[model samples]
Target: MEFMQADREACDRLLPGLRERLLELPLSELESADSPALALFREYGGTQLLIPADRGGLGASALDAVRVVRVLGGLAPSMSVATAMHHFSIGMLYSIADLYGKDTEIEPILERVSGEKLLVASGFAEGRSNQGILSPNTVARPVPGGYVVDGAKKPCSLSRSMGLLTTSVAVPRADGTNEMGLLLLPADTPGISVHPFWSTFPLAGAESNEVRLTDIFVEPTKILRPPPGLTAQLSELEEAGTIWFQMIVTAVYTGMVSRLAALVLERGRGAATDRARLLMAVDSAAMLAEGIARRVMSGDTGNDCAAAALVTRFSVREVLTQALDLAVELLGGMSYIQSTDVAYLTAAVHAIAFHPPSRTSMTDALLDYYAGKPLVMA
Candidate 1:
């Protein structure tokens, strides 16, 4: 009946020894740019957690993945944020493979991901302000065999350590229009480079830098095009991607807040009622995320599920924000002045509001969906 004990045990079972190793390091080191958390994650087979067991991977359920992410967020916020991007991209790729079967050109690459433990970084428009989540910032020019991609993803997580870069691009058609497509390229491919971008100290270890692709040539097979005639609105793949992104990212932040809640209880910072409220806030958010994961596992990753995921994410955001404030207050000024852990985690938890489909941007869309219209992300 301990707080988050089941999830902690799940983390131990899924990625044995990672939590202990991460705990052995100081929080300052674990949150810094030079942190070894990502390396330790890869060494412990963290990359294979979502690749499906039959495909040479763990094939963890959506619920298990959320639990594992919650544990990681508590230990290393940066690693959880960076790996969320990786998992989102992996989920999209593997979903495509499942729909199309073994003939996918990306099948071997996926095999490498599960078999070799390669990390994939997502380059979606989520980082850009006032843009549709499905919009492509990176441009791709059609060539004889493939495309010469040109653009950059500022604040792309896992930029420094990713083995593969999967990005959304606007591909120009011969008929004088553009279509959204997903492109997969090796991280070391010619003309692909990473540069300094993320300047904030919090989550600095995530390597959220600018990844510039200057005329990087990719083969035709490497680009995943949406089925024809679906350009006017969100595609099924885009829906799934959104759901996965929102669910996993929410879980990561929830875990971060859970850490603060844990500290509050351990120190017995307040009266019985106060302690119960703090734990309830954090646990409620955790359960909301789990609800979305259950929906995904039930094969309902369409517009309704996507909307539910967004609702859960924003709801958790409100709940956790209050919980964070309460935990810090209960911890008192002495704890704040004596150590940086409370301050650091509080700042990190605020980052949940900055993630994609931000509340401000999604307000009108959500209203329309509530009025019985389809959920739209534009």
Candidate 2:
């Protein structure tokens, strides 16, 4: 945790310089030099924070990932992950080996990840599916030696310069229940293919793509945990995934919003009627963000982190939208320039809506909380 706090400070200091450099590059260019970034990445060990310390990772908390989301969201948005996002994933399954315990097949995988040799992408989204439904179209049908994973996952978050993905497939059980099992797929697998699928914000480091798994045979060892609902154990893991996801994702959007608010304040100077309003928005949102972060850090569980997260998310979207309006209103023609962050702000407003349990979904979730449905991941 101390290291994570230190990493946050380092990223804060490094971001402005990095953003300047990022701006200089063509937005269309997809590849980035891994060396310099990796140096800073190594300093913090990047997404390795999500992994466990025993496995050579920072073992940063769900909130720690949230903190990272804020930092990286501000610096890079969704265009490229500053470092690879680990599929902490089943690897987390390995880290807790004593309790839920280890799978020998995943130990070396986590070792390589902790060593920073391989990249992991998350494949979750599916086409034409209902929001918040875990049922996936990607089928992992049972076969003689292993399951044949044959399906295409749409809008999966991946790295352009890297390979490998961790995903879940819905299996039909003889017991008449659907099962979701996770898998780790290598980039070089014979039948696997990837294609980029841009989101609302072109620059959000999300870098999702369509992943097609064509009759690829995954060994039993590489298969992640058993299907969801198979036991109370799987349900617990799902909740944990929900909790971590909410925290980290909230971190990213709110971070971008925080920066956008700051930019608005810096540029809104002398703009007359709107300056005071913009200042209030930024300062208000900042206070809210800081307060909620403190609560999360103190390990406060009873508090409404979900509602606080929604408010933070809404605050970010509000501030960014206001900032863009203020930027166009204050800077006149210069706001239209391609080099301006105002342009980026314009894109980010749309980008925050990319993931599920989105603003609308989040609002519903928050409402459910108020209705006393118990702040469960639902």
Candidate 3:
């Protein structure tokens, strides 16, 4: 679901005037066969794009974040992914700083993040990690000063310009269960190396990677608070927050859907019947997405964040597929032209339809959640 166009006005006020100009520029990068989208993050001051104002940030909340991004994402399908990635980093850091790592030493970094001085991206994926748990196969062995992190993280968005690397590494804790620790590895650190090139079909604008950490020493201060206890509190915490991030992700895909819907209406405006129903579905899906975001942002503790994520994703999936079908059916032969937006529109649908947190796992989780069983297969 996407936000109403009018809602974007309030969301825009959170950022400086520079955002509009940035959005207006042509940023088709790889996805569009041009300059990479990573450039845009640098233009917007990276992670500082939407920090909350109260904490020396842009003062954006969940819904505001959703509205502003969905609008831009609808406009620039390829380039917007990088923008959204930077925002994700900002959101995660801010949330983490608030919950655990509160020492004043972090304030300066937080300030830099708020000011968008450095770009950051998540580095949690590992060769053997479970996509659902976000566990990393990387290992962090404690060293004299800090720890040596060694392993590869796959498909890290913005790996090139990312100054700060936030990752999860397998750290054996006192408890029998393997504990995952969050580590901050600077991009310039000696042993850290990123593959020179990266690309994804729909997110051509953003640069992702196979990130390698070869026994790199990270200072003790760099580690964010170790994830909360894995047993009880953390399990529940992960369950709650994971869906929220997923919801944020849904906005990117549906944002594009909203744009396609608008175009269909503009093209058909009283001209066709099939296109009208498709447009209605797209518009309705966008509204539903916005509603879910608003509920979460409003402090509704009862929000089924995961459920919303699952339902929203499935809805958007159907919305895009149907929209594409309608485009082809209504436009007839014109839609088949490779040069037309019809192709990109449908390609993007498939792109997000299969984005990480794969549909199968999402459905399984949703089923168990609704069935009220233990969330895992024994």
lDDT of each: 0.89, 0.53, 0.61
TM-score of each: 0.95, 0.74, 0.83
Per-residue lDDT tens digits for candidate 2, residues 139-245, read 77789987788887666555443446666677667897766666666677888887766545455355556677898887766765553335655544444444344
Output the number of the lDDT-best candidate. 1
- lDDT computed for candidate 2: 0.53
Model 1 scores worst on lDDT over the 10 consecutive residues at 226-235
Sort by lDDT, top down from the best: 1, 3, 2
lDDT (tens digit, per residue) of candidate 1 on 27-47: 899999988999999999899
Comparing 2 and 3 by lDDT, which wins?
3
Runs in model 2 with CA error above 4 Å? Answer: 1-44, 60-68, 80-99, 125-137, 199-201, 227-233, 257-268, 271-280, 286-311, 338-340, 362-366, 375-378
Number of backbone-clashing residue pairs for each candidate, in the order shown: 0, 10, 10
